[model samples]
Target: MAKAGNGNWFARHKVITAVAATVLFFGVIGAVSDGEPDTGDEAASADQDWQPDAENDDQSDEAEPAVAEEPTPEETEEPSDRDKTPKSPEPDVEREYLVVHIVDGDTLELGNGETVRLVGIDTPEVGECGFEESASRLRELVGGQAVTLGESDEDRDQYDRLLRYVDIGAMDAGYRLIRDGLATARYDSRDGYGRHPREDAYIAADRRSADITCAPPPEPKNFADTGGGGNCDPSYSPCVPLYPPDLDCADTGPVTVHGSDPHGLDADGDGQACGGD
Candidate 1:
């Protein structure tokens, strides 16, 4: 009661305020006694969302495959017929022809007057049995039809005739002639139908038909002229005329008679004319 009587007496009351401040600090230390770091601010900031780079998204899209394209018809073109067919290796035959004129057993003249001798084949004379048949067969095969021609080593023969082989389709005219026993296979320079497949048959038929089909030996027109039998034919007078009497006796024999040499038409030296011996 006496201290509260004057304000100067309160100046000495500092000890009481100090005791109260010390009690408050001891209470705050006891509340923070557990060890802990303050990280609540950073935890809230880390919860924000994150974003990737735009270049990384572009790289992922580029990893996918691209679309494919198809080819056109022009890129897969094939070969033509001309490329498949083989080219011919021979000289081409001249065109512009029609009828083939018969020259002999083995020769023919085109409509243009060009003579062509059959190649790789030989036929009998005109008087032979199969000669006319051969000519007729050739005419039937190539008289008015077009044909492919193949030449021999010799362009022109000594007789000034062209030597050639004729082909109709795939058939060889020469081989057909030989197969039918109408001609003999002759391998001079070129090979047609290869070396005579039916040679034996042709040869046998040729020998069998020899007597009747072949040309007969020329008979002595005047045996007196050839030194042979003349009295046998009494109707014909036996004249002692010299050989080569300058008379043509083509009617007497089956073949033509001509003096090919100088010896009075006696080629064998038999003291005869054409057919004495």
Candidate 2:
């Protein structure tokens, strides 16, 4: 009976040893399979919880890029220097007339096929210095606007520049253009076309040109110390009162002065205001 009990104990010990060995083998296989450091099942549970977040990051990286923001109007840069100055006034003319074509500075072909010369302004002619710039500026001022032809006493000149008063309403593009130094305010007889309400405003701007420091001043007057011996016409002469700066007696033509209530020298034979000289 004692021998039988010993055999049974030996068999039970062998069975227990086999079970321990099997558990150790499985633990080692799980740790070594991924070649990752092990902190037991607790670390594995933490990593499994983070798996969904990793998948979300991968999806975000595959999404399309964001669109860039557009620049604001003030932030936008002008394409060129020409854009810095507006060419024409906004269209607000009471009368409607189509521009047939541009002849040169201060001149335009009308829809009625009339060649209208803009009055009270002289622009650089083609082939003259800065002519192209002046033409470009003129185009900008009248290119797409409605125009009206205000007739003058001298409808046509020797040069065929039709003298007329131009308006784009209160916004006087002519005056604005001259004030900005893009044109010269030239005068003519009011007997035909009369004065524009903005004429004085233009004159004021023209007067400031004398103050422009860039250009050279006019030649010294030839008048003696007595101040009145010249044989030139007093109406056109700069030695007399009211002549424009830098203009000589020879330069005076048939230009009329607008907005001055008092009578001045006459250039044309007509008794109207600003008729001559």
Candidate 3:
């Protein structure tokens, strides 16, 4: 007879216990080998995903776009407007003005009773130096002509005159004024004014302008007594003899033309009757 203790129990169930333990060990091993690790923490920590994206590592990357960010209006906004070629200047004059009268070298009175002052130019006033010559030359250039007007940044000046550039056919009247020394370049980029289109050309012409050459004033009335035989025009020393005819320096040889040369003896316009500056 055996001892009726734990030994009896062990011997009776040995095959069953061995089978159960073996099944438990293999099931755990299979689950661990086939089922993957927890990837959430790893994916969160890493720059790249554990499973790479089909198109790009980043959805924002343009390299291989698949399900990427949609393009914006700014994408269309830039290329068309900013990248286009620059434009050329267009013709400005739309209609023409018929010049009826010349107010001065730089001013005009049109047939419609509008007055326009030449933009970017200044000439002598009525009683100032070169006034007669400036006025005369303007008449010769554009009087009674139909001229096209080009506007500046400003349309009118302080005197309520239209500020414009006058053009006859292809000839620029303002440029002619500056080139001939009848007018000087003004109201341009220089001297605190807006610059006009032809400012540079006018300045260049002004540099090459002829020196202003006109006449000197005539003599004092009592500079010398007219007590010779006849009454004398006191514009000169030794009585020029009042003009029955307009005289020239050709008539009088080097007379002292002081106050006013009524006979027009001072061809050179120097202080002496017929001399140079």
lDDT (CA) for every model shown? Answer: 0.59, 0.61, 0.79
The C-alpha RMSD in Å for every predicted model, in order, reads 13.5, 20.3, 12.2
For model 2, the run of ten residues with the poorest summed lDDT: 232-241
Candidate 2 vs. truth: CA RMSD?
Answer: 20.3
Give the range where candidate 3 is weakest over 10 consecutive residues by summed lDDT. Answer: 219-228
Residue 144's C-alpha lDDT in candidate 2?
59
Total backbone collisions, model 2: 14
In model 1, where is the ten-residue run with the lowest total lDDT?
Answer: 248-257
Ranking the candidates on lDDT from highest down gives: 3, 2, 1
lDDT of 2 by residue, 4-117 (tens): 999999899899999989999998997788797556888889877776877898888789576788999999877898767778878864576777576776777777767777
Q: Estimate each model's TM-score.
A: 0.41, 0.37, 0.48
Clashes of 1: 0
lDDT of 2 at 258: 39
Name the best candidate (by TM-score).
3
lDDT by residue (1-277, candidate 1, tens digit) is 6756665556546666678789988878877864455577577666554335686678777997766767788787687998889988988545434545776657888766778887666887866677778888888877777777665555777788877776676776766676667777565423444433444544554445432245666665643444336322322223333334444334222222233423234445444443433
In model 1, which regions exceed 4 Å deviation?
1-96, 187-236, 239-277
Which residue pairs in candidate 1 have backbone atoms (N, alpha carbon, C) closer than 3 angstroms, thus clashing?
Answer: none
Candidate 3 stretches greater than 4 Å from native: 1-93, 223-277
- Residues 157-199 of candidate 3: C-alpha lDDT, one tens digit per residue: 8888888889888888889888988889888888888878888
